[model samples]
Target: MNPPTPSKPSPPSSSSYSSPQTLLALINNILSIVLLSSLTIKSFTGRWQVIHSKLTSLGSSLSSLSSSPHWSENPLLQSLLPSLLSTLQRLSSLSDCCSISSFSGGKLLMQSDLDMASNSLSHSLHDLDLLLRSGVLHQSNAIVLSHPGPCSSKDELSFFIRDLFTRLQIGGIECKTKALESLLQLLSDDEKSASLVAKEGNVGYLIHLLDFNNYGQNSIREHATAALSVLASANDESRKCVFEEGGLGPLLRILETGSMVLKERASAAVEAITADPENAWAVSAYGGVAVLIEACRSGSLVTQTHAVGAIRNVANVEDIKNSLAEEGAVPVLIQVLGSGATSSAQEKAASCLAILASSGEYFRALIVQQRGLQRLMHSMQEVSNSDTLEPVLRAISSLSKLDPSARLLSSSTTFIIQLGEFVKHGNVVLQQISASLLASLSISDGNKRAIGGCMGSLVKLMESPKPVGLQESAAEALVSLLTVRSNRKELVRDEKSVMRLVQMLDPKNEAVYSKKFPVMVVAATVGGGSSHGCRKRLLAAGAHHHLQRLAEMKVAGAHKALQRLSGNRIINTILGRTWRE
Candidate 1:
């Protein structure tokens, strides 16, 4: 068979050809050739020298890496070694051609190959540098040796986080992305991890990944943002760090152009960061106020809810409230209130409007002009949970501070009935807000009859050991209601109401409750020709003793109430005691 023409020895298979030891041996051989060979092409000498330097550096890194246990099985090494071997082989071939006396390829082609080879060498060296800097070699060795289980202690977990954080700092895109996924999972599961991240100052790396400009790394950006959201929600320090690292701008950009899911996450992050009122202006500085308003107008329900909350937080900064109003937040928030969104979203929207309205009459007028009052009333009518109802009531309370809003609210019997229910049975907070709302609406005589039904509830609030502000608001509401004669008769009929009013005037209760509103309420009770048996009720409740003490203290309205009581001769005869007029 012609001596079976001996087949040329087959080249080594790629798997064996690119083994870690083989690759390292090839790199060292190429380095020697590039350093020692005399090139015929004078112009190519400098480029070959550059390749020599890179190969020497890469050889040192590979040698150090090879000493790690099972280094050949390391994923990073497995992935990079084959490509690195291929580049080194190409460089070796180019070095040989340049060193030869008889080269066949065009000089330009040869030059082009040299440039490409140098570039390939540089790229390989960069990747190797990343590998060394990433600390993956050390991590891989630890994994192979001990085969560690789940982190059993905070120190172990912390070391793991620091390792992952180091990977985030220097690695290929895929390596960094994997690190981020692991980090996000850790943060979501462990509150302690979030705190650790903040304490270790790794928060800036997380914030740095918020760059939307990173092409093809949308998932990285999203996970980074989600991680930040977890950190912010869990730790206050993380929230402040997020702002300090200029994270708001990237977060807002995501809100503007990111996917719906991304927008939701970004909005949530913004919401958490801006929860600190001090960070409010950072949002405005990044022009995020307008983006948040636009989100309210069009984002998904979750996005809208977080956007509203972030806007509300920003609005807490007194200066940003006007900026929010000017950005047309009023109309969008009104729309959110009237939309079919979740009750939480509507509640936050209401709170945002309440904040804006609190800025001044200008925002209140804007709300009314935009029908926010009607929308809030509608929201109030639709929801029943205290969480939702409280903000709605507060929004109405704030908007109603305007005369027009008060008039509009006073005309709605449903609203008045709702206010009565809240004042009667709602929690102390709702009771206080409702009482304030009633005080605002009580400016109208027509509202007096409708609101007077809450007299018993308002009077009972005065006896609550809660904050004095509630009592003050309730007493103020009662004073307004007492302006009508029938309401005064109603108050006098409830001996408990008269007694609570008298108790409020005591010098002992002075520090606990303001004497001004209670005195006015008592004076209105016994003031006019309609005093009837009300004067006896006051004296019977010892209103004279407390009133006299208050008058001595020069409490406003105390002297007037004492004068009104002293003038009641029938009450004096009934008590069998005479007072000097």
Candidate 2:
């Protein structure tokens, strides 16, 4: 942020005297005083020079104090807040009492006295913030906003707010030069106040203020951008307001026009809009997908996080998913999961992978083999926080949707067992969701003994005294494991397990089965892969004849089961070796 640079003071005003000649005379007297001081300094070589030097140094300190931030922790400076508040006769006094007419012919009036305006405004905001820290935020806010000080009006009230922000932008811009610090303070304020200024519709104003060549400083521009992040999430009505007001395009333009911070803020705003699923498609339609992907792939960590967040919000809906998926986001997100190890980046990549994986079978394979599952599991160890933990959740959720990703028994078992541990660690959400993923993995692939090892736990969960949600999730999990073509006979062989499942399917039992089996033939084939003797048991038990009838009818389950069975040369040859009776 640029500090306000000093320049030579202007000549005395013409109104100094009743006429121009008097002003000229006063100016001449001042010039003579300066000339005498120079001559006297020349006369006294060392002593006079030292005294002159000290006075000059004091003047410089005073000047810096006038415009520079109060540093020193000086009690006097700290006392200014309450002192100014007591002195302010009214809020209207915050402006110098000037008016400017807008192009729309609206009049904007300033209410505070010119001299104390900036100082008073700063103190007011500072004191209010202090009050809130003391825990009277709600009551204090109501009182302050209600104080119709001469500066108050719904329309005119905005001027003080704008003034406070502008001075904040300029004041901090002039010092350590980071107005972002102050802006973020406002941002971290409760959602209520952040929404107030954001909903007030100054987004376009803030965007315009972000010009790269602006005098105050880039840091000030950065602060404005920070403020925009809060505004973008102010409310749905407000987000649309920002969008319709053309704030969306200009805000996004910052992705290319501003610094890394600005880019992240702009990307974040786009994400905030996508949070409302209704606007998710609109974001894609408005060409934000490329911007989001560009940000996701190459932008800073902030941009990547927000970009991935936007993708996650949109991926839940169908058409929106195609839009995000089309922009080559899948490969980019996969790359983020690879190259970036930040918590947020990992989280987003996990979720995006889940969304894409669930879209179809090919996508499922794409996510699993394209190195998604491995990285997702790895991320669980890299970062902390609820958000970082979420991608694993989504990975599990998508696993439910996709079927399976790992082909090797070792890899699949490791991931499944790790997930079960997370579920057992006591997050019901994780438990239910993990159960769903385990179900998908078990049913989707040939890893049954692993499922069998957990069969007791799963079966017990199936009969647990949990809430309906847990019950439903447990049942779905069991179905996921049981849905594969091969598990049926083993589940049946236990007789007790089969009877339990049969009872689950029976209306006579208090418990309900979804009644929809994924595909019994698929289950049978999956069952066949579970053990050495299981396939022989099913065939010897007349399962092959039963399956042949299903194939004639073109049942999906039978088709898959036959395909798995057909792959075995011994089985094919033995079946072919048979002579018709």
Stretches off by above 4 angstroms in model 1 are: 1-13, 35-41, 44-60, 66-73, 93-123, 133-136, 139-151, 162-181, 197-225, 237-247, 284-287, 317-323, 442-446, 463-468, 510-513, 577-581
* C-alpha RMSD values across all candidates: 6.2, 17.3
Q: Give the TM-score of candidate 1.
A: 0.82
Per-candidate Cα lDDT values, in order, are: 0.75, 0.53
lDDT of 2 at 541: 41
Could you tell me how far off, in angstroms, the CA of residue 30 lies in candidate 2 after the best superposition? 31
Q: Show the lowest summed lDDT stretch of 10 residues, model 2.
A: 92-101
317 in model 2: Cα distance from truth in Å? 6.0
- Give per-candidate clash totals: 0, 23
lDDT of 1 by residue, 242-327 (tens): 77877888889989999998999999988998888777788777888889999988999899999988988888786678787777
